[model samples]
Target chain A: MTKSKPLPSLIAVIDIGTHKTVGLVGQIIDGKARMLSFSERRTEGVVKGTVVDLEKLHNCVHEAVNDLERVAQRGIEEVYLTIAGPSVAGERVKGFVAVPAHDGKVTARDFNEAMLSAKRLEPPAGRATILYMRQPTMLDGKSVENPVGLQGKRLEVNFWRVTMEEGNVRFRVNMINAMSIHVRDFILASHAAACALISEAEKQGGVLVVDFGAGTTDWILYFKGHILCAGSIPVGGEHLTNDLSVALRISRDTAEDLKVRFGSALHRETDANQTIWKDGDKGVGDQQFNRGTITQVAALRFQETLEFVRKDVLHQLEQIFPGHAVKLDQNFLPSGAILTGGTANLADAAEASTNVLGLPTRVGIPQFEKEAYRKPEYAGVIGMMKAAIEDAPPPVRRPQGTLAWLKDMFRF
Target chain B: MNLFTRLRQFFSPRRDAFMGPADREWRQLIPQDVRRMPGDELGRKRAARSRLPLVLAVIFFATLGGIVWVSIDDTTAVVAGNGALRYKTDGFYPVPDLQRLVGQGKDGAAKDVAAIKADLEMDTQIASADVRRRGDGSLEIILRERKAVAKIASLPGSGPMVVRLVSPEGVQFSGAGYPSEAIRNLPEIIDYRTSGSGDKATIEGIEVAGPFLLAAQSAYPNLYREWSALSLRDCFGAQEDSPGSNLRVAVRRASQPADRPVLTEIVFSTANWRNELAILSRLDLDGLLRRPGITAPAYVLKLSIQNRTSARPVPEPRLVPATTR
Candidate 1:
């Protein structure tokens, strides 16, 4: 064999989403994500993040994995997995209790206990399951952001508990494990999207993370460094693309391309003036459309979705910030809203979400010191990697014989 | 090369008929007007152009011997001989400090060279090796590597692994570290004993006792892909498929495990190779030979080879009509 130096470590995420499975491998070199290779395979047997056909899902993962292995020329030992679906649900819970009589101060252990107690609000038997346990703020005595080192009579933890189905989680893990890769950790799609796109200050002050994924639009509200509440609507970018496909009588791919290139949330009367070309074939296939009309069709669906999200969010915001009495309109962005996920790429989506949510909005692009880690799509995986790296303990090396044996014999 | 030659022959005209003594008479068989086919001015011009390159080739070849005698003699070896080999040495495999090793050969110089050569080759069994001075006063050496007991199936391809060997005691050796002209002779490993566990080839099952080789690789020296068949015997009771056995297995095609596909064979390797071979040799392969309509068998045969080591009685042989040997 030719003597060549061993290749560098390249991590690839084969995100088997509802619409597509994206296989992207990157090497984290010098704390920077350098892209080594990428591949995309059509996903099947996956509905709203739940796998319907085990074999079909396996095939999709296999194709992507095979392609990545061919490109990277290395074995994939493990993967950081992300999951999102209709089964997933999120809610905010705050635990409040007095400090111990002796300590006279709230400790980190107190915060952890509060967080765990808050997570206990939702059980695993019935509802899907917890995707992530995100703790943002600790309330000590009052609504203090950081409760550490603070003397207080009572301590409270406000966090979000993201849950999905146990069956779905099992199916996904089994599928991944069957591929001979370990799932180091699991992260909720919303939290991952939020962590990737939203700034620390925004999360500390107040911010909302909206992930318009394939099957659901997940919204996570953060305030005072804690997850206030989370919700998901079945309507998403797929619905808009479907609307365009149906209205224009075009193939799904063409509708998607049109939606990506020309479709916008804000529709104008002048759009009807511009015409789009269609092929000479009948409705069966090969057809063109008025580009403006396609845009209008896409806008109608987008507006309806925005309105739906607006009503749901407004109701929640009214409960939390009753003094403010926020009205979601076209005026400004949500103070805490950051749009992310694959559907977040919709042209002017962040601005549109801002317009509807009535707060300052920014496209949630993952902010990592690394370049490859800066994408919204990788938010979940990078977050999982971050958690693993932070939580990982230093390696302990065992001593060999001889000196070690002498040391053992002469141990004091 | 043969495929290309056949392709050329297919497109070329037939020469058999034209080689006849009365070939012109055969031409007259077509028509009188065909004989005067080149009568037209266009035909005459076409004939002249076709012969131009042919004439230049003959003139060029006439002075070829003279050119060769004047310009090429001692320089020919550097030009057309082993020049490519010399270039390949620098381009591919440059020697790695031969003199440095010679310097390191302090205490038993010849013995040190022999030991170093063995280590370099990854081969343990060196039949004979010698390090001696050459005509140029430089050290010249000859070495023979250990033979390959088995050709392991490497991932993606079955190549480099040909240089590896596994002793009877399961110690793996390779010739990767040595430079030798002749390949060492090794015993042919036609069959292997695969168990639930071990450092052999294992495909799927996680529980193993002896080497389980899913596929032969350098990492697994005990197994190879060249063997036409494999017989797993002498497995431990834990690796057996008997009623009282802890290990139970059902072999079926990877695609359809329940349907009991004949293409996929299941083996319960409980202990040693002897028992595994006994189980295989006892198979009713003759009964199922060339039988059709054999999609998949429920279970072909259950061997108690592994059970022999235990106090348990040998299990009954379960036969399937669907199985064709």
Candidate 2:
């Protein structure tokens, strides 16, 4: 009889947002993701990335996972989830350790000791650290890419620590656990987006990634191939829709439709004379409004959101490198800012970002083999899968010996 | 609690205290990425509640499928073959012979696999038959045949005498497909009383002699090759441990003439035959017969008597003249 081939191992990820919850199941074969199945559902009981009603959110998340299982023909036991919103924040901390070797060579053990010392700093009250990103290592007094085999008396390292409120994280964990699925690890939304959209060259040249969701804006700053800072704000596309609804005396649904169809982030003088109908057909409920009015309302909200993010980035930079004369210009961030997420689909979004942040910007769409996955909204979930594969431990190779062979023979 | 009170409790937000400096100091020793958050008991309970219906449905359907499968007749679709019988055996029984022995009907109809298995096992020679129906609509069978240790002759009332083979278990059956030379080589049991006929026939004292012969045939082939016939006249059936109850085995003469006397018969007590057999296996009979002494044509070896001349009694075999027996 011929032996049957074994099936490849699959990885599953879920991105829970204020507007929608998405589930993806696929296999990472030879460092490339092969999509198997995907499902998404409208979110409820959540506002601005915070769980407000546990039962309603549980129903939404459970249905999405069930649909994915049906299509993939497999059940998901654990998943990598995305975390965002105002409760998430980052801080930079430094650690120092003295070299113990008589030859004064820095070993792997010294590097580990310095890392351990750096992580010893705790988050503020009622918050817990969720992730740690290592920066450059310093030997003696100079920064070195690798400290091993180098001579140094004192070893120091800097780590960008990310923390979140305990109560908020618990709410998310409880919601997912209610569906009989475990949360394996939490990936920050901005970090996941950067992994999907930012290339190695872009990271090496310094870049900023801003993910504009429906209810929140998360951004991460990468300088010299290391994460300098990351933060989130409680303002997104929904705020713009709310602004248009109040300004034009229309319902929220009609306002959203108008914002998607005729809205622009940069209003032009010629748009003042142009008129557009709410509904394409001249039906009884259809109404006409000046095209300029739609652009004006959307631009105000979009620019204010970008300004807030820019101000936050500058403040964090000042805190990290005080009196270093840092600036958000081409000299520091050579690759400029890359915009992504669902809200980034707005017309002239990059233009608005450049006008406000004073840096050249462009919208980034996640590139994938499947055309359906190459959209702004899929960047977070796709990036989450990539992060999970990159963070997984390497496969262990067994030693070939008589004892090992005997153990294998009797394994069954 | 009242509905209002329960509603108030459920909606109330829970505030957790921050970790102290001591706890943080110890936690920092471990890598932050590998650390996991505390478990949620209430969430786990909710998950168990959600999985209950799915688990129950799977179990119910599995049990129902098993019952339906067992209720159906498995042999209704047996593939066409020679008498619709397929079997393997280590003995000399052929396919057609086994089919005839199982009594397959002349009418071409599928028979129950269980019934076929039972019919095959009914024969005295077959120890067991493993019957199964393959997925391709064929009946598969494996048979383990019993080994014959000795032969016997019985004369029913006014009928001709018939020879039958005896198994190690003392069961007698017509040895089918056995070579004539192999059958002739087996020693015959003479002067024994039997109570039954056909495959169920029972010898009066075979229980004591069958295993003794089998043990010698397996462990001491050189000595067993000299045996020609066995006599059970002195053995008492059911009361084998009585005083002086013994079995006599007649030995055949050798083809070549020897200077020493030849063994005529070996006698053993029924109660102590196992110990006597062990002692007999260790004795150098040929060497003893060729020792310097008076010569005789034939002699009888008696191993059932004990030598009591010493303080401790020891059982030993003694040689006597054939005329004394």
Worst 10 residues of 1 chain B by lDDT: B84-93
Kindly state the fnat score of candidate 2: 0.03
- Residue-level lDDT of model 1, residues B1-325, one tens digit each, is 1334335546768633232112212111211121122333433443344455577777788688667673344421221132221111111112333223334445654445465455434324444445544333334444444433332233325444443344333444443433443123222222343343323444222233223332222342322232232332223324444333322223323333343234334344343323543455456543543345554444444443333555875644444433444
lDDT of 2: 0.80
Can you give the lDDT of residue A241 in candidate 2? 94
For candidate 2, report its TM-score: 0.63
How well does each candidate reproduce the native contacts, as fnat?
A: 0.00, 0.03
Q: How many angstroms is residue A112 displaced in model 1 relative to the true structure, after the best TM-score fit?
A: 4.6
Place model 1 in a CAPRI quality band.
Answer: incorrect
Docking class of 2: incorrect
Stretches of candidate 2 off by over 4 Å are A1-9, A74-77, A98-105, A139-141, A151-154, A174-182, A391-412, B1-325
